[model samples]
Target chain A: MLLLAVKGITESNRKFLSQYDVTVVTPDTITAQQIPEIVISYAWDDAIGQKILANPNSKLKWIQTQSAGVDYLPLKKLKDFGVVVTNASGLKAIPIAQTVLSYILYFARGLNIYASRTHWEPYTNQYLVTELPVLVFGTGRIGQQIASHIRAFGGTVYGVNTTGHMVDGFDEVYSMHDYQKALAKSRVVVDGLPGTPETDDFFNNHFFDQVNQLFLFINIGRGTTLNQNDLLAAIDDSRVKYAALDVTTPEPLPKNHPLFDRPQVLLTQHTSWGEYVNAGRTGGLFRLFEKNVPSFVKSGTIQYNIVNLDKGY
Target chain B: MLLLAVKGITESNRKFLSQYDVTVVTPDTITAQQIPEIVISYAWDDAIGQKILANPNSKLKWIQTQSAGVDYLPLKKLKDFGVVVTNASGLKAIPIAQTVLSYILYFARGLNIYASRTHWEPYTNQYLVTELPVLVFGTGRIGQQIASHIRAFGGTVYGVNTTGHMVDGFDEVYSMHDYQKALAKSRVVVDGLPGTPETDDFFNNHFFDQVNQLFLFINIGRGTTLNQNDLLAAIDDSRVKYAALDVTTPEPLPKNHPLFDRPQVLLTQHTSWGEYVNAGRTGGLFRLFEKNVPSFVKSGTIQYNIVNLDKGY
Candidate 1:
């Protein structure tokens, strides 16, 4: 099987792939004549991916992404082409959950105030996470991991999903239609929803206006799910007490953007998934790829992380 | 019974104490001739406490402190006066433990690096708490709470006390005499030991030299237990990767102190115990006072956090 890896796999991983009778080629080494049957790419390589997809002689049957979110991929085109799509879901769960906890505790313990202090000024606006009732927007792998961690700290976890089906680790689950009740009780709101047309601008003025009280806001999921202007207004009106965003629309969000300078905002530049050591090669992503490869070789499909092309994850 | 509460009791608490037949008086109301049988004071009321204790006609039989640590109190003099001392131990456990976790997660998620960033710069030095093995010195209420929180994140918790006896919430327990092995394996070290003569400068240069690797140091314990210069030297030599101190000797540690300016150090200005809402009056201290009031009124002595005046905790 010919596989084209735009980036992320290491030299050692390339050697490992050799044992599977799979030939791996990078963008530097790939020729127009050598159309790969499988392509492994991350979100940023879309331009190169477009060129390969446009090729009339392209033999691509499946695209495996290194990112949990495949929002940046040409989903409709891939759907039309009948190419199977699988993502690295659950690969970044641990680190991303840890980052979410960091944001929660950062605001809970007033580290946001203490971090910039040059003199001895004790802050008292802090509260314990145990007192926080958290409402997580998505109940998938990442949200579940986050809920488990919050539960460990004796905090209440309220999960929201398309269906209100109860998930393990969450104290309660609310469907999208009935989440307003949970939202009213939660002191902390976390956005773990993926970026899809349905979710784009989901957290806008209408949503912020429903918040019952001033609360901490955290975004570890796709940034497109939020309206940046609405969030700023929420902060201005004291509906959102503080916000820690690991993801933002137009990432590399302009250096002079208003969000960058707000004391109530903590922008991490989407580095939540960057923490895992050698993430692409020996870490979770590689392990996930290793699990899917043998099955993909025998059949033209993968069972794990198979995104519904029509619905989009 | 007459009780002198220098501070911390609210008007509502005073009314509640009335049901117990206890008359609460502040410094302004307590005349020299009006010697109270019991006193409630915090760490900062030492001068007034000294004056009250020096009154030869004093009927003072007990001192109930709002602080967990009694290091600032006149322990020897209280012992000489045959005064029983009880502190608000376990009261600050939850919030203090939350603050400790905040410190751990802050560094683990690279907030220390990203916090100051004005532009989009992703950092890769972040690691999950699960990857860190923590060794906490002192397994009292606060330490155990800290252990449980770390363990919840799948991190190993090694506890150290005077005895090596196993404690709940700790993965392993080591005695002060034999903590070197645990220390060597730990990537994060926390000082939760109380301030006492024996614990003075316990974390000196000799102690820091025994560290096996570059580690994160956290002090939620009394400041006197740590030797600041030794810690600074360790940081300079790269034996200590980062330090987050909630307690520091002579805090409001001088505004120009080197520790305050170091990029690797996070000085929290002794605010770990300050986060509780209305901490002095309606919070933990007052709750503790209420619990102990009934027992003290029924007998000459009360239980719950009785301090060995000679030991100074």
Candidate 2:
């Protein structure tokens, strides 16, 4: 079987994957006509989607995207070819969860404010900071992990999920319908949902206006899921004290971008996932695939496969 | 039975204690001449020590100090009176352990430096930063807790104790004789030893000079146990990169002290045991005491209550 290794898998990881009976190919190294059985598309939003679609062969059994979201993938075309689509959904959960908790704690206890202001003077007033209650959207693996860590650090956690399945560590779990209730009660709101037509610009002017003005917000999932204009207005109106963004629209946000210049905004260049210690490794992915392949073959169901094309993730 | 409500134990706590067949008395409220069955002294420093000694307590059968350190309780007077001495020895273990781990991650990963620096600029330079290892002194309740938390965060943990008992979480547990060896290999050294005559100035200039120059050190134990001169020299000679002190000599470190002026130093006015969310009620110590009191009454020996008068705690 052939597998495409995109976004430059580490040399150490590549060496390990070479041991398996898999031929690693890059988009530059192959043509659409010679479609591999397992097409590992790194940039789901790029030409890779078209490339896979061009190959109308039933031989292309699986499309393993190196991302949690597949909004840009040609789902209809893949379906036509009877291609199963699996995603790197759980891979980013650890780092993203860590980043969310870091920001929540930093904002809740005013650590960033204390660190920034107390440069020349001794920290006297930093002692008066108070704790915050957090409401996290998309209580999937990433959100659940975030809730667990935040609860461990003494923050009250509430989550919103499609199914409203009660998460183990959250103080309260709510269905997606209870968004307004969650927002009303939270001092901080974290947007961790995938970008879908329904979810895009979910944090617009109306949504931000309703959220508590004292709320500190964060977005680590999809950048387009937020309305940039509403976010700026929220910041200007003091509705949102600060917003720490890991993923942003127009990636590599230009230095002069207003969001970058916003006093309360912290823009991290999509580096939340794949950090220094636990960067993406193909060997780990291959091991996951090894376990998943037999189950899929037996039951005709891909465990992490994303469906519901309209929902986009 | 008589129970002395020390350490400003609130009327609420005293009321709770009164549920048992015990009478509560404070030092200021009760005369020493009219000594109760047991005198609970919270502070064992010079000022409090002289007060206790001034009271010739002929009827005092037991002395239960709220502090873990029995150094200043006039142990000699208690010995002369044949009074059984017990202390709230493990009260601060969990909190101190939480603090130690907080500093371990903060220093090892250079979180403090990053938090202190201007993170507005993009990050460059991709070389291995530093190896993280922590050496904990006094492998007692607090030290072991620190080790457990540090190890949980993927740090290499080494410990030093009097008995050299094998601790599960630590990579290596060494006796006092092998502390130098442990220190030599550690990236950070956490002082958790109680303040005794033998431990006073325990982390001297000589000891600092023997370790790596890039090392980080912290003291969450007794402030008087450390030599300020050695700490100053360690910073001056570049033997230690930085020192995070929760406890410092002459508590509430004077405004213009050199250590306060040092940029590398992070001083937290010995407030690690502040009544924060989970900390206000660290029931571990109380639970241990409540459980062992009956056992002590039956067997004449309590677990973890070994206090040697010669070396005070």
Candidate 3:
């Protein structure tokens, strides 16, 4: 029996999974008793998910996540128990790239100001996306796709990675040590980095202060990596002009949070990588689950997108 | 001597035209005496601009317009007077395409809905630009560029033209007669067609009624081509969900108009073909003027982008 944590699984999806005996578990009802059978933690991003992972469930062979970043998962503990993990990474690249471009366009096209205006208030300073320089934090699937999308719009993409070996689609790659140089050329800084101890709170005040021509800060990656207080400080000092945040520190971000009220902050509530055509958000999540199940059933090994325990991504 | 009608002629621009004897004329200041001496009517587009063209000027050899569409001008009379007409067509294509994509992304990324939401209310029906079928009218520089941009985003593009010969970047091409067949498949319809007598008020109730799933009506072209009554009627009947109009009838569209009040309409107020990085909007116009000046000086002829009198575009 497979424990499915994804909510809003349509009837058609259940019919598609007719071959497997599946148990649906929501945040409220998931218990330690069901932990061992929980093969997949699809769409798992809440505190209740912590308990499910914490309970020693030896039978839990694989945890397939709908999110690209597997940072929240207790990967080190899971690895000790020989549990394998895979993420829905490639499926989200398009939507996330679109979201990033939307952020750039929101400012570059002057939509941020124009959307609120009741009368003609055209700004003299607008730019083509091709003319702007964008810096992306990761060189993985999401990073490459975002770079390609920005390039398509005629923007220069600067990628930052550990070693900074040449990456596809990016105009230039900056090593971890020299990333500040790359950031200096950029008008837009995009966080596509997965969460790791190295990445935690990396985008603090100092990071924002080093930025040049800072128009927009985009965080489509794990939110834990960005310091919101520092971001606000940067905004206040005009080091950072605006922010388009898809992910945040606290999921569902308490209703009374200041980020919700700030005009400069486009708080997306983490809905960037979502639905296709008329399909629901679960369509991509379900597709990822279906793709992984066959391999897991045959080899009892996860071959694709298996997260590194130390990296926690 | 050339008649430069464009405002904001910066010092750098004057240096670019150092070889020519240029006479600047504002719309309010231009008189019949000045019109008679005007050898070239560059960047002409106002009511007095029409008067400058209508008043017989024997010295006039070329009439240059900064607009992509020449439909508003009296093309037949200009041609009859043995004058060549050039336009700033290619310059606006990129910005115009960017604007159209902004509208698509606005809806696709749920920015349209999310922008208005006072609280967190993320919609699940949003789509990637690449997943949708985009219907484009007119297969010129602007249309082809728009199609290329959409294709880069992973969307299918349907092109409609007079003959509908195979065009690059478009997934399919439909003849003018068979455009309705293509429109039925698209949720987004982009009007890039230049205005002409044959195309006047072409987008009326009948045009909207044939649309199967009209999610957005994007006009980055001339406004005279679209009938406001039909667009409003289409919106009232729920056939058209939203509109992103970059151009409109009697622009500077009187303050109290309902278009400003409507949430669904993204009235850009003719600001789509806007600023470049260091180059102003006049960069392309200047380049066009610079290109034509040398040739006209030598051969007494303006060659490139000379509008065909019969086409009125």
Candidate 4:
């Protein structure tokens, strides 16, 4: 019997999992004695999850993460134990892409300024989408999805990756070492890189300075890659016209944080990945399960979106 | 010498007009004495314009209007006087389309609510642009252009016109009499109709009630086409989710109006048809002048966007 862990498992979810001989468990009902029986875990980042994964006799042959990033989880421990880690990455691609498009449209169409004004003084800064160029950092699932949406809307997109590899939906690609060349032409910069030690503080003052034009910054990735102080300074210097941060240096930024009060900044409160209706996040999790559970049952392995332990995506 | 009427005509503008040996005139400088000698008038909606148009000895052969709609002008008198009226229509299509798109994207990505929240609880009503259905009223130049932009962004559009004749960029077309069928499936309703006796207050209580589901209303057309009280009632009844209006009944809305304070309504202050930069409106007017002036010089007729005195558009 496969021991699966989850949260708020409903009757419909149970009906979906009834095809296999599996026993579902939750944090409140689980105990240390049951750790050795758990063959798969679908939840993480909680105190109970850490204790469960810490078991020496844990039978976790595979783990499915319901989130896109896995940097915070025990990557080393999972690799050492010979367990395969898979993530639900592409599931949130379109939703997050929609959010990114909103930011670009908000600025390009002058809605950012129009919504605040009380008079009939029309803005002169509006431009067609085809006129602006956008640069996206990290040509991964999220970045590629964002690029595709931008392309569909008649905008130009340049992508940044480790090796400058070509990707669908991007007009051009540049390696991280030579990304400044791309930044010079982009009017909007998007950060979609994952959180890793090597990427920490990657978007420093030097990175912001390479942007020669007034631009909008959209950060939908892990917050560790950006230096908040430098971002504030860039905004102050007028190098950045505005910014929309779905993720920040710290979660639940203090009530008096300056970023919350700025007209040029929009704080989205990190809810890009979760939706309260239409089974948004939960629906994606189930889709990942449907694709992986069948493979894991027969070969003790999962096929889709398996995170590279070394890269920590 | 050609007599021209304008507002704030700059030195650069005079340079453009100097090429044709034209005398530029504003409302303050013009008089009935020059009306008989005038062969063209380029300004409207002022005391001087009325005087010139009313001039019994007016030698006016053609009037190049600086606006899209000709309903407010003396169309019957111009028709009787045998003066051709050409308008600057296509000039503002892209900007107004951008404004309409801003409203759609704002709702699709939940930026409408996300930008207002005081805490970290993100909104979940978000959906991709490609998934929503948009219904456009009046399949004229602006409507077709807005529909095309929505199509480029992957959304489906249904157009409502007088005859329901097929138009590009729309998945289907519905006649004005049958517009209710289109509204039933639309997640967004775009009003691009002109201000005419037949169109005034057409989008009244009955029209808003046809919207079975919660949706956004974008009015980039003439404000006279909508009834404000019914719109406010629809919002109060929870049938309309949100609204973005670039035009209103009065030129400058009262400072303490309720629409200004509504959380669901965004007043863009009649700016969609004008842009601040790119010499936006003036640039369009000049292009219209260049096209018409050469044609008028060759023949006594204008070659572009000649308004029908009977249709009044």
Candidate 5:
């Protein structure tokens, strides 16, 4: 069954589900209406968590989310109701990693400036540019891929990971707790962390204070992980020159939000996942549902199921 | 030695005896003064031919140019005078090739348009882009390097050369005769041809006509290879979507040039060789001169030494 609560997927996704035996159910359709055997949850819709938690009579057996982070989903409520929770992981790894590299190259070459019609100067070509080091938080598959691509372009790649294993392309890899040292050494910071309670406010004023001038910051993973106050303070202090965020807290971030009008801040409407337009993979949610239903029913445990209680994505 | 000439090196080129021993001289610098032992001519300078043809100096033993193209340097005049001409060939291959790939990515991913602060709109995170088919006009060292770098970034590379030999990273290789067909099929074109009478207007209106609307043209070789009138016509016809030029006739193309006003064109003041500003290499001319002079004096021939007076580099 298709779920409307998912933030990034909607009417277009429902059309794709029609190809299968799935039917879309919006918040209106799900209430005072017939219930389906399964209900999918989009990571961005936490309010639906309360609705699903309040109605145990519908007998929901499976809960699938369209986002990689399942922390926001009411995993405890789903678990109490014996509902299985799974996420749309691995799907965003490549695209998100590619987007990270795009930011790196954009900052390194000053390409955005060069490509602009206004900055198009003729004699200014004789000027030189200094290269800055990039420090990436998290060295998972997406982070490794980002590091490799950045290194290919003659960039020094540094990363922070739980294991701190010696990765191939990273000039230096550090433990997660050692991020402070990495920040001091880097002029560019990329946040690609999975959002959990531990991750919220990971990039705060303290983090920004360590970044050098003209420092660039980008976040593509979770909006809640960033502290709006900390980011604003950092920009005000001129410690961070610019920030390009794909994900932000309270997305469709209010018009009056500081980030929306902040100088040097490029707030994207979370397009890192939008490459699917040309990829022709918009039916991903339904496809994932179709693939997991039978297994979830037979095994009583989804193959890629996420446990909210354990907080493991 | 640095050579700064206006029109071309003159007959008095052989008169500057001590000026060039440690200093650089152009045709302009030698007019009212004595001729230096060494004269530097760049491929960008079309006036070199006139200077050499007018000078009948047998004492001029060496000529060095700041340009990679040796075609315009008076090969016959220097040969008859037993003066060897060395070129600054390999200096710009890397940066020029990098710029070429940057343009390819800019076109293929539509980054050129999206990166614009004034033109960009909020886009969904699920957008994907199709790759472009790129054609390199000259499959020499710079072309080969450009093809390699572009292919590394997941681009299809096509190359054209005199011999049509197989290149490692290119999907297709064609001779000059097949260039028209190649141009017809490719979405992007990069011309690195030398400025010879034969090559003048190589990319004329007819060529621009064959280019598709998706075409992104780049010229890093000599400006004469592209006819200004033809390029302007192509821009008007909308045959080329974006054009990035590092070299053009009339270096500092007049302020009133139509291209300066074209929105689709990005003009760089032929400074691809300014690698030193980016901490790449310093004093490329002096290094090239020092390395090739002894070899030219010993073997009486130099690599990248252009000879065909009819072709005119």
Candidate 6:
């Protein structure tokens, strides 16, 4: 079997993969005729992916993504090609959830204002996470991890998903139709929803209007899901007290954009998942790949994080 | 009974105290002749406190302070005068702990760098709190609260106090002499110690030299306990990775001070306890005062948060 491993696989990980009785090729060394049966990638190489799908003799069976969200991939084409997709979903949950809490605390503890002070200027508008109820959209692995962290801080967690079925870490679960009730009670709203046709522009003016109180809004999910203008409007009207956006529309959101000038917004440049990339010899991403590889080699199937391409998550 | 209630008592709290047949006098209304039997203050008025103590006929029986640390109060004089001193110890724990977590996450998640970026510049040096073990000095109410919050995030908490006695929230407890072992293994160190003669300059060059790894330092404790030059030296040598000081020796830390210019340091002034002050009509300070009032009226001693003058905590 042949595997195309991209850059970022550590030295030890490369050594660990050598015992699999498979030929591993890097992007720099691979030729057009050498389309591998399997590929491990982070940022999807559209040119290479298309070439593999185009060749009738291509043996591309599965793709292992190094990111929790696979929104940047050509999902419809991959689904049609019957290419099995497994994501690094639960791998980034710990750090991503920690970053979500960081955003919430940054605002709740007044670091959004205090961190910029050159002289001692005490701020009084600070709040405790325990004092505010949090409403998180998407009760998946990322959201559940976030819910657990919030619960640890004594904050009420209201998880939102397609169905209102209860999740383990959430105090209460709300369906998409009923999350507005949770919104009314929450002073913090976190978007952990994946990017899909349904989720695109989901958090527009109508969504922000449902909030009964001034709330802290955080987006660690997907940039395409947010309507940037609507967020700005929400801030201007005092509906959203502050926003900490880890993902923003058209990231590298042009320097002169109005979002950069807004003191109430904190832009993190979509780096939540960057923490564990080079943390140690054995990071969660490599461990996850190691776990999926054995099953894939035995039966051409992955045991975990199998993304349902048709539904787009 | 007469109670000198300084500024910041809400109208509702005043009404609650009025039902007990106690006359509440503000600083402006209280004359030298009308020294009350009890006083509720936040920033201790030395003039009023001294005058009440010197007057042999004065009925100053107890002092209710609205802060966790009563270090600013003349502990020796209060002990000599035989007046009971009760502080609002646990009242600020939740918000202050939240602030402490805020400081930790601010650096761990790379907000200290990313927050200032006008353009999209993703940072890779981000970390998770769960990846680091924390060593917190002073395992009292505030330290315990911080421990619980860190535990919730799956981080290990090693607490320190006068004795190596076991504490509920900490994974391990160490005495002042034995904390060096915990410090060696920790990547985060927090000072929640009280300001006293023994604690003054306690976290100096000798203490910073004991750390085995590059660490994040946070001080939510009294500023006098830290030696600023030692902290700066630690930062210079890269032993201290980052620092967040909520308290400084001579605050308002001057605008031209070197501490203000250091990108690695985050100065929050001293507003961790300021959150719940004006939050609602029934804030924690008023509630603490209300809890202590009935006990003080019935007996000369208070029920909770009685300060140990000799220990100065």
Best of the candidates, lDDT: 1
Question: What TM-score fits each model?
Answer: 0.93, 0.72, 0.89, 0.91, 0.78, 0.92
Superposed by TM-score, candidate 3 places the C-alpha of residue B164 at a distance from the truth, in angstroms, of 2.8
Candidate ranking (DockQ, best to worst): 1, 6, 3, 4, 5, 2
Q: Which digits, one per residue and each the tens of the lDDT, describe model 2 over residues B1-313?
A: 5554454555555565556544666666766444534533332334444555556654455555555667656677677766566676667665555555445444433344445433344332111112457888877777776766555444578888877888877889998766777777777888888888778888887677786674578898888778888888888879888787777778656667877677677666665553345443333344434444454445545565656666676
lDDT of 6 by residue, A1-313 (tens): 7777764666777777777766677777788668645444433567777778777656777787877788888888787777778887888888889999999889878888877777766777777787778989999999999998998887899999998999898998999888877887888888999998989999999988876446689999999889999999999989888898889889778878898888899988888765644653225666777787776777777788888998878
lDDT of 4 by residue, A171-199 (tens): 99999898877888888899898888888
Give per-residue CA lDDT, model 3, range B263-288, as digits (tens).
77887777787656544456657766
Better of 2 and 3 by DockQ: 3
Given candidate 4, what's the lDDT at residue B241?
A: 78
Name the candidate that leads on TM-score. Answer: 1
The DockQ for candidate 2, computed on C-alphas, is 0.12
- Enumerate residue pairs that collide in model 2: none
Ordered list by lDDT, greatest first: 1, 6, 4, 3, 2, 5
Once superposed on the true structure, which residue ranges of model 1 sit more than 4 Å away at CA?
A8-20, A36-48, A55-57, A279-282, B10-20, B36-48, B55-57, B279-282
Clashing pairs in 6: none
lDDT for model 4, please.
Answer: 0.78
TM-score of chain A of each: 0.93, 0.84, 0.86, 0.94, 0.76, 0.93
lDDT of 4 at B6: 64
Give the Å error, residue A17, model 5: 10
The stretch of ten residues in a row with the least summed lDDT in candidate 6 chain A is: A274-283
Binned by DockQ into CAPRI classes (incorrect, acceptable, medium, high), candidate 5 is: acceptable
lDDT by residue (tens digit), candidate 2, A1-313: 5666555555655665556544567767866555535534432435655655665552566666667777767776767777677777777676566556555544443345433332323332221112567888888788887876665555588998887888787888888776777677787788898878778888789888886575578998789989887899889988888887877787767657788667577665665553444433322454444445555445656675555554566
lDDT of 4 at B4: 63
- Where is model 4 more than 4 Å wrong at Cα? A7-23, A117-123, A274-281, B1-34, B43-45, B274-280
